[model samples]
Target: MTEPAPLNGFGPLISFILSISALRDWAKLLIIGSFFETCRRLLATVWSSTIDSFFLTASFEDHDDSYKWMMIWLSKQPSWKNVRNVNISTGERYSGNVPDSEGESDTSGMPKVCYLPALSGSYTLWYKYRWMRITRVSEPIPGWGPNHRDSLNISIFTRNHDILNTILQDAKKAYQDAQGSSITVYISDSANCWRELATRRKRPLDSIILDPGIRELVVEDAQDFLASKKWYAERGIPFRRGYLLYGAPGSGKTSLIHSIAGELELDVYIISLSRSGLDDTGLSELISDLPERCIALMEDIDAALHNSLSREDTPTPPNQTAEFIPSSPRTPTHTTSKVSLSGLLNALDGIGAQEGRILFATTNKYSSLDPALCRPGRMDLHVEFKLASRYQADELFKRFYLPSSPKTPADDDQEPKSNPAQSHLNGSICDGGSTDLIDLGVPDDVADSPPSSPSACSEKSERAALTYTGTRHRGHAPKLSSDQLSALAAQFASAIPEREVSMAALQGYLMSQKSRPSEAAREVSAWLQKELATKKAQNETKS
Candidate 1:
């Protein structure tokens, strides 16, 4: 049937044949080109996903100078939390002609991988698997097990202990927990947990529980203070609270604060004005970004005062030059190296919204504090954490000696539950041996009832004592009166030398004493003796 079609021009038939061959070759080439392009795309996607998943990130936009400044400044901070064995992949390389820039690969920034047990009683760190990869988990890991050995062995084998097995396990767990049903777990080389746990080395707060007498007095004040915080919260304002604790050097101010944080189930954001080199701007930014629910503390406000603002009020006749200028040198006058108090003030409770910010400022010199600082708008409640009165001692004992546990309501009293005197005490002391109520001397009669009855001890003077005990009461902490707490705080404050002692030091000391109560007690007694001796000598000199 096709034989009839051979009757065409020779030139036309030849052109048609050539056209057919050209079309066939073009089709083959297109198919080959498409296959290569698909493979390249797939490889790129795989590489990017792997990098993104395996590494933690700290993004800094290349176009912004602030990003560069942040990186440089962060690098200079010796105490900054390290990023750990992380491999950073900056986007800049992916910009312009390059891809995968190595600028962010500062291994030094990564945190050192080390063993950190879960604070919760759980020994297992929980992790989940996704898409054949361990994704996210938050459960505690075995404190000591195969994983621990693997971590140590890895350190030995790779000589790069940076990628610790325990750390990987931890990171893997966290990743899996966060990923949910995702087939991928994005493990971070470094855990932000280090930054949080660093303060674990701090002094324990329980050691400064008040003596029975002081607890009675201070417990109520603490309650009122808490009530005030709740009052603000009830109005729908952010449930932020600020405390200004000022008193003698050995007062239990700092200890009281730590106890409050622990009892309230809150995180503590401690800002040592003397240490963290925070300019007004830096302090403000840090404050602004603080977690919505936590405590922000600034210890020793008097020492951190701005010299300029202080001088402004000292009998200076409006910009008058000093009568006696410095004779040391015709030195070029420069702005005095002073922190801007106004800047700090604005950063705190400025005209702007500071609704949810909880600030606690402590100092031994209340007189040195500016009146404006303690004015109604700023530190509205000025409570002095003072020496332990008789009432404070008992409360302090209860807080330190008691073992916190979930309690059943007590039915010991037939008096109306509404009556402050009839409030039944719940919760039991820890199995840890109990110290004699007054073997060391000091009144034991602090309070007879539970701490929930704020009204029973609700005098303004008793507010601090009652409120302080309220937090400890539910947590298996000892139940000391305000008087006892005050004395305990005083005892603790005096333990450190006259020189500046950090909250960390205090916390560490307390933790040490927890398992060794006798040692802690002896240390406390010795410190108190020294403080009394010093006070007596000062009085004689004044006379």
Candidate 2:
């Protein structure tokens, strides 16, 4: 009964047998191919899972750029606080980038910083529909001992491999942009702790008025030197800049230094030589721990430590020195001052010195400092801040007085006044003569009356009244020309003969008579004469 299928004809039976062999061969090949295909799919799934959970990490070392950027990035995210304990260390930010209810800008008093999450905490951030997991970890490498300096870690997890890099780059860019608004200054309070002393509002670097050559040179050097960090690394040199600003008091040394700091947006860490507890060790520590992109200012250093460097030569400008000698500083007699010359020098160019520091040492006594301290590399550029030149004085005068104009603002009633104070904004002045702006310091109110005879319009008549025009506290800007101020500045500069009058004195004098440009111009000569006389008398007394 089981062998009944063999009843078919022999030809049909042969065909069936061939079909079975062909089907058997095809089935065997399919099974083998399916096995290989399954293996390939399994491998692809494993690789993709490994990559998704690969655990890419970025360890943050204290004071490192990455660590700084991470902290800054954490401070910016609104959702970060919800994930972490962020109630402490909160502060207000004043950048005007925030928006308002009416779609207008309202940037005042925005929250800047809040305490971020501690270690071993995880936060998930979503951006552009892509989710990223951030886990704070401090796993140690097998050989790295416990309490490693770089123990802080920020583990970034994402399915998209490129997301982590993109996040880090965006953070770095944000940190840079945020720092552009102000400059910070750090002062060393303890051996390891540098307390933030001040945060200076940014000033336009162009506002610093110096000799044109000096201004150009300082600006160019600052830009070139800061940008040349890579150049310095290749050459194996510390990326630093040093400038010595020395001259008479009130010559704008300190102001120039501040301007440079503002221009570079670098913090200024002042090492007060006169500070009671400061010694060589303390100073060295301060120098070594200086954060990157900072200016270390040791102002009035010549007077701070009484180093008995040679003072035989008269103080001269850097360019004026026909005979420049790089003298090795002679040791001074041991003084009560805590700092020593050797200690100062070692901290300056020491092997352990911090990189990316700009140093400025200002002194009134240019010849008083030790030569070795002022040598090249340490004091790469020695600039003497002298009294304001006639050109500078003219500029100073215009700067002080030109912004004072606008008695008749466009909204302040179109009606003209009969007096010089309220009426002189337009080219018209209330003078008795021609109804034109008194270009030569003469106001319209007191100008000599139009000639009834030729004798009435005399030069002396108009010039005499010019003396009183600049005395009033008029809100209007001066009608004086640059040429006119230059004339007065030339007179002021010429009286001293030695260019000994400092800008500080000139500024004070001009500020006192700020409302009186004509009076300032005319009286500046007398003031300079008196200043010179007093200085001479003081020198005689000291001698």
The stretch of ten residues in a row with the least summed lDDT in candidate 1 is 185-194
Per-prediction TM-score to the true structure, in the order listed: 0.40, 0.59
- The TM-score measured for candidate 2 stands at 0.59
Off by over 4 Å in 2: 1-124, 128-155, 159-165, 227-240, 291-293, 307-338, 403-498, 529-543
Q: What digit string (tens of lDDT, one per residue) describes model 2 on residues 22-58? A: 7878878999999999999999999877874755556
Single out the weakest 10-residue window by summed lDDT for candidate 2: 322-331
lDDT scores in order: 0.43, 0.64
- Candidate 1 residue-wise lDDT, 1-543, digit = tens: 556676569898777876898787887899998999999999999997776565432223322222323323322223323333222333221111111134332233333222221221222111222111111113334543222210101111222334344444453454333222222101111111102322222234445554334433444544555557667667755454566766545557766666655544345666644333446665565566565555677766655543533434434234222211111122123443234777776767754434555567876555546776676656756765444443344344335545445453442232233333222322232111121111212123444434344343333214333333211111123555566555555555444444223233334445545534344555765544654586557656645
Q: Pick the candidate with the highest TM-score.
A: 2
